[model samples]
Target: MSTKTVLITGTSSGIGLATAVAAAQSGWQVIATMRDTAKAGALLAAAEAAGVTVDVRTLDVTDPASVEACLAGLDRLDALVNNAGAGHLGTLERESVEDVRTVMEVNFFGVLHVTKAAMPLLRASKGRVLTVTSVGGVIGQPFNEAYCAAKFAVEGFMESLAPVAATAGVSVSVVEPGAVASEFVSNVGLADNALEQAGPYAPALSAYLDRTRGAFAHAQTPQDVAAQMVELLAAERPAFRVLTSDAARAFAGAKLKDLDGSAVQTLTGTWVA
Candidate 1:
């Protein structure tokens, strides 16, 4: 049998990079992609250190042309890991609609584009689609309105697509992770004047930022989360929804059992108070 190929997006850093390296080490022909191949330094170094190799490609997930260009070059795709996403930190009134749209483009629409394009290859190979969503997708958080909304859209899409895709010989699953220690946190794409112009929501924003810092202080490592992803790839029967950590499971569980939505409401309400 030919070596199975797995294509991953946003492989320049964070979970994407870690997963790319780990998957390669596990014998998958990893197609590690990023918007800028110039940023491939760290990924290359990590792969070298792991004594593994990954095919680096440029893929801007927000662009369908790029998605097509990337996938068109691949002959066989055993799996697709939709890890390419951008984070935004702002409330609706505080930010432009365009800002939220950009968030959706990267986090939600990007997933759709890649998944839609990869369905043919995945279906042919009877492969799986694993998306790296956030715990925010399951339980909304303060000051995370835009980011959470995008992730929510993705989770809903994947959940709905799971059974449908299964009929096509393709499997769809989402992995929700809690706070992770990585450049993803620092690169939330929040504007510089955001805090200075926070004005009325300043205190709440401050509180949320502080709380976020605390959570990420003890955040899960990218490597740990990557291991779970590799495990999912190797699983003969992977679940539709998987939480990557005890913290994520516990946090997401709040909303899972909340009938009136009061549980998550009361819980997250305290973050800003």
Candidate 2:
């Protein structure tokens, strides 16, 4: 039996890095990719520390040419993990349209770019596509309008494509993770000062931040989420949607169970007022 190969995007840090290492440890050949190869030292070091080897590749998911070039030499692809994403924080009214577009470009369109680019190989190998979406994709939260919108778009797109991809022998799944200890908040520009400058939204933002901090106090680790990804890739029949933790399942379940939207509104409403 030959070892399976998986190419994961955004392997410079966080979940992407963890997934790459975990997959390698699970006996898969890992092609850990990132937008900038210069930042790959951490992933390489981690892989070495884990007593595994991973091929580091440069891939910028938002750029179609880069996506193409990254996969050009790949002969076989057992899995493609679209973990590359960007974050945006602030109310829709305060966030610039450009910033919102940027988030969509990376979080939503980036997935499409990489998935589409890798689809031919995936189809050829009957591989799997696992994406790291968020609980926000299923349930919109306060002050996360733009970010949630992009995630929601990813969820919708993947769900609609899953059946069609299945006909070609490709399995697609979205992993929704709640708060995990990662650089996501920082990457989204949600530092303390940034939240403090919310102006009229400060109080609500503060409250939301407090709640988020409390959540992170017990947040799942990136490796925990990575374990789920690895399991999905190895499953004979993977589910369409997977939440990383009980909290994530419950958080996203609110929207799934409440068709009227009142439950979500009431829950998020507390953070705003």
Candidate 3:
């Protein structure tokens, strides 16, 4: 098989960075991009040490012009990984509309913008478009309403796009991974809107945030999640969704069961009250 050309977004850190390195090591020409190229020294060094030539560029997924220009840099792209995302921790009622919009712009619309810009190249190569979503995409979680909403939108958008892309000789797959030990948790952003005034559940919300911070104390490494992406990329007939790690698998399975059981409430009690 010919060497694949993969373009991965958010390569400055985390799973995106890991996937870029792994793909490059596997002989795929990598276009590793970060919001700010100046801060990508670690990624660049890691790729270099692995003997894989990674072309680093600046790409803020929320910018349309940037997306077009970045995609133009690549000649024949085979795969596009929509991995640029961030979390805004806060409950839905507490989060401001602007905060939710910002999350959507980066986590959801960012994927759309980058994917739209890269579709032509991917279509030409009969390549694949892989999105790094989360377990939240499949099931709702507390204190992550904004983030989960964005991911859920991604899952719906990609599911709708899959059939069309397949007919056009392109493939779309979503990788929903459980929490991984990346800077995402430590460096996560709180909903600025929620932080302002104390609401009805202010104490509970504060406690939730504190508990969440503690939970990140134990997260899987980015390498494990990246490996799943590589396998998905290499598969000939890849599924629509690839839930990475055991935690992700269990979450997805439970969500599926809940959805199916909802039709037969006599057998299964209420899930969402």
Give candidates' CA RMSD values in order.
0.9, 1.2, 3.6
* lDDT tens readout by residue for model 1, 69-158: 999998889999999987778887778899888888989999999999999999999999999999989888888888999999999999
Q: Against the correct fold, how does model 3 do in TM-score?
A: 0.89
By TM-score: ranked, best first? 1, 2, 3
| Count of steric clashes across candidates, in order | 0, 0, 0
lDDT of model 3, residue 106:
95
**lDDT for model 2, on a 0 to 1 scale?**
0.91
lDDT of 2 by residue, 1-273 (tens): 799999999999899999999999999999999999999988889999999999998899989999999899899999999999877777877768997888899999999999998999999999999999999899888888888999999999999999999999999999999988988766877766866578888888888888878888898999999998989989999999999999998888888899899988999898767
Best by TM-score: 1
Task: State, as a TM-score between 0 and 1, how close model 2 is to the true structure.
Answer: 0.97
Q: Give the TM-score of each candidate.
A: 0.98, 0.97, 0.89
Q: Per-residue CA lDDT of candidate 3, range 1-273, in tens? A: 778889999999899889999998888888998899998988988888888888898899999999988888778989999998997776666657998899999999999999999899988999999999998898776667788899999999999999999998999999998878897774556546654564776765666666655655666789988888888888899899888878678757877777555533432122212
Compared with the true structure, the alpha-carbon lDDT of candidate 3 equals: 0.84
Question: If candidate 3 were superposed on the true structure by all CA atoms, what would the RMSD be?
Answer: 3.6
Relative to the true structure, candidate 1 reaches a TM of 0.98
C-alpha lDDT values of all predictions? 0.92, 0.91, 0.84
Candidate 3 regions with alpha-carbon error over 4 angstroms: 191-198, 210-214, 260-273
